[model samples]
Target: MKTFTKKLTFYMGKGHIVRDITADIQAVVNESKIKEGQVTVQAGRSVCIISTIEYEPGCLSDLEKALEKIAPRNDYYEHSKRWNDENGHAHIRSTIVGPSQTFVIMNGKLCLEPWQQIIFGDYCPNEHPEWEVFVCVIGE
Candidate 1:
């Protein structure tokens, strides 16, 4: 078995930003040179998340709206009450959705659905200077 890993960082300006990282993940798969395996994408912070979603205008808008109702950024979270951090909502949002995702690598390509795209979503809009994502690829 062979294993490969890589790390990436991004500085999100905040306010519900969704970025497609499919290419980046694919790049890692290529770099790993793994013919068949699995890759895991994870965020470094608890306030952010990694997941698959349709990278379309309408679906993207709906996704944001769903997050708003699920874990409204403006709502008061006990985490914020303790830390006095407005990003408490970010914690809740990430917990509800999760912060990491796994994808299969086939023939050195990501086996993703047509509409599915990997992305890092920021539910909390803070002046966070940077966000990091870690990739782990392992298999034959």
Candidate 2:
């Protein structure tokens, strides 16, 4: 078995930013020549999440709304008091969503539904000068 890794960096603005990264990941799998195995994509920060979803504006907006309700930004968080950071909700949101996602690679391609796509979400309340994403592909 062999493992291949790639990193992507993005500068994110304040608020939520969801970007579809399916094609990028597929390129990594292709570069690895991993005909069959798995690809794990991970976020490099506590305030970010990696997941798969229907990459549509409506769905993305709904997700952001749901997250806002689940972890309201205005709510008081003990973590905020400790760290004196305003992004306590960002941490909670990331925890609920997760920091990584794995997809099966078949026939040297990502096996995903027609509408399903991998997404990298930056949930930080403030702008992130640099957001790093890691993609790891393992197979033969």
Candidate 3:
């Protein structure tokens, strides 16, 4: 078995953002020469997540809307008092969604549907100035 690890740094760009990581991850798998296994995308933060979904304008809008519904920003969050962060809902939302996603890599390519894309789902966390991402590959 072979294993590889890579960390990427990024700057948040306001609002909800879904950045594609398919190509970057593919490069990692290629470097490891892993013909079959899995790639996990992990967000190194308390308020970020990963998901596989279609990337489109309306869909992006819907995603932002959905997060709002799942964890409304205006809602009262006791955590805010503890940390004094207005984005307590963001942390809750990311917790519920998750911080990492694993994708199966087959025949040296990501095994994903046609419309499915690896997206770094950034809610309020995207508004921050700094962010970190983890990419780990383990395969033959």
Computed on alpha carbons, the lDDT of every model, listed in order, comes to 0.88, 0.91, 0.81
Task: Write model 3 residue lDDT over 68-117, tens digit each, in one string.
Answer: 89899889889888977677887887898889999898998989898888
**lDDT of candidate 2 at residue 118, scale 0 to 100:** 93
Ten consecutive residues with minimal summed lDDT in candidate 2? Answer: 8-17
Worst 10 residues of 3 by lDDT: 121-130
Off by over 4 Å in 3: 125-127
Q: Of 2 and 3, which scores higher on TM-score?
A: 2
Q: Candidate 1 residues 93-132, lDDT tens each?
A: 8888899999999899999999999999876666777889
Tens-digit lDDT track for model 2 on 23-138?
98998899998899999999999999999899998999899999999999899999899988788999999999999999999899899999999999988788768899999999
- Residue pairs with colliding backbones in model 3 are none
User: What's every prediction's RMSD, in angstroms?
Assistant: 1.0, 1.0, 1.6
Clashes of 2: 0
User: In terms of lDDT, which candidate is stronger, 1 or 2?
Assistant: 2
What does the lDDT read for residue 75 in candidate 1? 81
